[model samples]
Target chain A: MNEQEAAALFGALSNDDRLRVIRALVRAGPDGLAAGEIAEAIGASPSRASFHLSTLSEAGFVHAERQARSLRYRVDFDRIGALMRFLLEECCAGHPDLRSCCGS
Target chain B: MNEQEAAALFGALSNDDRLRVIRALVRAGPDGLAAGEIAEAIGASPSRASFHLSTLSEAGFVHAERQARSLRYRVDFDRIGALMRFLLEECCAGHPDLRSCCGS
Candidate 1:
């Protein structure tokens, strides 16, 4: 990803509530969690949770699917992985020893 | 890193100037670059670069050290790697195929 895309992804994750939402979804695993569960887990209002989730989704950090009536959200692993790779893309260039900085 | 630490680090990276500064420093590699060079490379004033550099350093994304008169700055790869790991800690919690989310 380019700097602007990475910046946008980081911008989506720079909030406490959004981070909490991501962690909760990560813990929830493949089944994911409904909006109310996420709101309750993160101690955020329903509307606030919805807003943050939408931001995360728009940034490709989270995926939302309609399950029955409520929408379920799950962390978008591939997108997140791409983000991690973007952050460490060059990773000290060809200095193999410097791989520690790239997280090995 | 914990949620707060990760949040702070992401907060530091959320700005465009800081992101450019990081890309410049990453390209500079081990020798690093003086504050003035970073400022020029990123099209930022010395003071502005210094402020963002300080923020990145405080968040453990960059390291600064004095060499002669000017301080040189470099990306702290290990710290950055740790941050990446923190973001992908669970990685689908044992679903091997889901490893894609962790940036495999």
Candidate 2:
């Protein structure tokens, strides 16, 4: 993941509402949840949920799939891991003595 | 780190200038860089660098210490690691089949 990608991902997760949406989808498991279910779980209006989902999907933090008549959203775990690695690389590079920073 | 902390950290990193400041500080090592150096490295004005540094410091993403007449800023690696863990925990909880998502 490059700095630009990490920056975009962070921007996507910055809002409270969006963070809640991501959490809701995450708790919904790999099968994911429909748009309405995500709205219900996050107590967001359908329009707001749709907006957040679109932002997340655009940032590559989450993926959306057509499921019957509804859309299912799930966290993109691989992309997220790459983001984690990008940040950890900086940490270790900045502090060699703290090379164990990401070991745990 | 909880959702709130993670959210605040992400919010701090959402800006392009702030992200550049972080990259500069990371490359500067633990001793960090003075505010002017950060501004120069990122091509930000003094006031702008100060604003970004204050936001990052407030969010606990960076730490600042007085160095003579200047202040040195360094990334808080532990806080960053905790934020990564919080996000990873959600991924694993959301998808048991992806337990290795964070292993790499």
Best by TM-score: 1
CA deviation > 4 Å runs, candidate 1? A90-104, B90-98, B101-103
Q: For all candidates, state DockQ relative to the true structure.
A: 0.50, 0.49
How accurate locally is residue A29 in candidate 1, as Cα lDDT from 0 to 100?
79
How would you encode candidate 2's per-residue C-alpha lDDT over B6-103 as one tens digit per residue?
77778888787887887787788769999999999989899999999999899887898899999988887777666666666642453433335444
Residue-wise C-alpha lDDT for candidate 1, range A3-69, written one tens digit per residue: 7778888888888788889878878978999999999999999999999999999999888899899
TM-scores for all candidates?
Answer: 0.87, 0.86
What tens-digit string does per-residue lDDT give for candidate 1 at B1-104?
66777878888878878888877887887899999999999998889988999999889888889999999998876776666666655323433333454334
TM-score of chain B of 1: 0.88
Pairs in clash, predicted candidate 2 = none
